[model samples]
Target: MEIYGCSVTDYSDRYEERLNLYKDKFEDRDESIFLEREMINFKDFHNVLVSIFNCFIKNNDYHKLINDPQFINHLNHLQNNYNDVFKELFQIGPPLLDANKNVSNPDDIKNEDNRGYIFYFDFTKEKVDNLIVSTKRILKYLNNKKLRLQKPRTPESEEEYKGSITTKETKPPKPSKIPAKWHALAYLIELKSKGLKPPINTEGAFIKLELEAIGRIKTGLKGQGFYREVSKHYKDLDKPEILNKSFGKDWKDTILKLFNSNIVLKEYIDKHY
Candidate 1:
């Protein structure tokens, strides 16, 4: 069963282990040198640090860390000296939730089946507020450097560059006729006036009149041939009704208008000729 956005069956013991590690590190202030030595990579070190930090934040006891004079002094020193490094290291992204609404343990996401829960941090919330502030400051500095490197351009030179490129104008292709029922004949006529082509089929006419009982076409004899041609095509049309049903009530009119319009019909004639 799915729970917390992930399958419950996929939950791993690693999640519990990570959670316990955070609890131990924060609650006991564990200062084991082995922990530091074991974290050989930046990723591993960041994970351990963020997990412990989150545990403290989530527990709503920020004072515990703040009250420690040494930790406070270290935090202040880092903010002043290596602020960029601290932001990069501590900006944890959004927590992944399982189908059961439980925050996914980062370790569990290493598996392929559980990968979907991993997402970038949502900047609108608490996860990256501090990080966002730091990023903005870094970006401002970079922008100033970029402005220094930029060179001014003359309008005459810009116009010459643009004139060197050529553009081609091509006509759009004509739309195909769609067949419909005889009860839809009037609708088809309205479309024909607008330059649309509606393909009528024999079988569809019978179905529309007998089964669907759509109203009959009321146009004069001059338009009879066009209606009959469409009806014949409708009977012969090979596609499924379910697929054609989505064409909408006025689709026949739209198609006929496109078929009758010189702008559209010219393309069809050009293609065939």
Candidate 2:
């Protein structure tokens, strides 16, 4: 016999004993005194069981029970035993989106369906577009400059070579030999001060910063590849709030002034070119 659809095995021994006593005294015989006592015991036991189950289910740690098949099965059995109780206590269906709408077609409605509506949120793509443009310009400049620097070797006859024993100048200018990493670090510092979040990888961030600096110094050193590379890393950092605040304007002016100071750029040109 089941009370509230729960089998005898599901209840504690005391509860089972009280339930059995109630059934035997109330239904099979005319012992009203014993029946009343056992009935009250059963009701108290059921309420205690329900309270304990409610506490367990409401706990945040109860989510761990999902990893145990036995626990999950036991929970399901308990749920079935007190289906009406459970239904009254918690939501049993998919979540609602806002008070008026159900989230039945989340994927279908996600793509601009509510665009232009006051309830819909839209992002301005202007900053991303400008980043793409500037990145491309810088990259193009770098690639072009690299190509131009590749010198052609002239072949000489053995007699001419022997007659002219002068040593070929292969030493790079002192400024060109200055590590590109330093330039990159300077640029990163400037960008950071202006609220841009630079890449966590120091080497990668420095390389990109140096490329942009190089592009600024040489107008003809444009390459789409350089732009794409720098833009890719820059966007990955994703601190667009800094750019949106027009900090790049001041950064650009400051970098230009430093470039013209003949302290860094002059040194680089003398060594490299």
Candidate 3:
């Protein structure tokens, strides 16, 4: 239900129907499953991803999601939904080390418990620790991005008084990243703008093509001959595999590079196109 905001967008009615069917099929049913629960937990993963992107990617804040307790709790909850709950997620207190040894309490002197054996934790903590280190490095980079934490002016300086600006330097608003589901639409728009032949046929066909390409919906409406005419004049028009899976992920980046300097086209893309 809450899938729209994170990554994929512009869901077709048919796709939505398929999504719900899958959801119903998995829920409250005892069946051999490997990745079905993983798919359900995708919603949770996307939630965490969206929040992290907002705090880190959108704002470029020095504090990453790794620093947030709520994020940790959310991730832990998600893990509990599928992970083995018997295992410990973390050890609170630091390991007491007098030397390269496990310091045992002399009062509860148990010979087997005092044995010098080092047991390693599971992959979960390893992943979390890696994330922590990575976030620290990434935050350093974010902080280095042109003095990230700029202080607001209180009109203390003559320049500030003369300018009478209400807030700090406001950069121009960037165009929002177009959704992956709408990549076909955006591609069509771009083609039309450049006076180039449209890919496949109509908008409906392109939408179906995109959904099938990304494994979203499988209606088997194969239009293999749709690109016949287009393919004669150009390469890659006929190949259904031309748009790889990451086509939607980095489609904007790829398309924008072609018209990055074209201000008019860029504005049009940000608005109507």
Candidate 4:
């Protein structure tokens, strides 16, 4: 059975672990020494990373791929949907050890485009499942990292950067009036207009946060609880009678107006919320 838009089986149990590792790697905090027994190489992993990003590029949905919770869920669903393809590919491979046994140094495998051989067989259901966990974790980390980087500079930081020493204490900046949903909605609609599809998974963490910020849902909801609430919300919205009354008959036009403006969604959301 499905909860919200996600199947219970679709989520990886290793999501949090993968997320932590992804953050450590992204921030250069991971100092763990590598071991040959790990059964994967830097080159092989790097190729997977490249392949993931390349998929986004080929679809012309890199922005959505990174920052859109729905899009991320869509990617997860796609990966899950290809289970048969993965199983079939894994059936035809000679052991990778045979290829590596001759090489004393892993570093000797330079500038190698081994994705053709590696991807085809390297991913058993279990291995791909682990990789899927890592992929989602990394995507979430990168998106949040990008958001943090885009956050507006505080007055104190700005002043310190300018080397201005003021004898007078500075007042804190006023809170912004904008809500987080607008930013999410704006981006979502833009991607839709561009013919990019987002996942039906409205229960994802980012979407939960956005909905909570708008007072449309309660805070601290997650997993099955989160999915149930969002699913109920969507069920309500799916009724044309309710939808028309809530957004008016021209809701699509109203939404288009909100998203079509050229303002940077994240910047405005950051500054305000």
Indicate the residue-level lDDT of 35 in model 3.
Answer: 23
Rank order (by TM-score, best first): 4, 3, 2, 1
Worst lDDT window (10 residues) for model 2? 116-125
Clashes of 2: 13
Instruction: Give the Cα lDDT of each candidate.
Output: 0.36, 0.38, 0.37, 0.38
Candidate closest to the true structure, highest TM-score: 4
32-137 per-residue lDDT for model 3 (tens digits): 1212222334444444434433433332221232445555565455455534321233332223212354333333535454332122222334444444444344
- How high is each candidate's TM-score? 0.17, 0.19, 0.20, 0.23
lDDT (10s digit) by residue, model 2, range 1-273 = 133323332333344455466455334222222333333334433543444344344432322323345544544543566445334322332221123553333444444543422121111122223323443443343344334443334556666566554545634223433233333334443454345543234454433433443433322233223334445435422353544353443433344454565455445433422
Candidates 1 and 3, the one with greater lDDT: 3
For model 4, the run of ten residues with the poorest summed lDDT:
31-40
Alpha carbon lDDT at 71, candidate 2: 42
lDDT of 1 by residue, 127-179 (tens): 43443343344334334433432323335666566756433532322322333
* Candidate 3, residue 78: lDDT: 44
Clashing pairs in 4: none
Candidate 1 — what's its lDDT? 0.36
lDDT of 4 at 189: 40
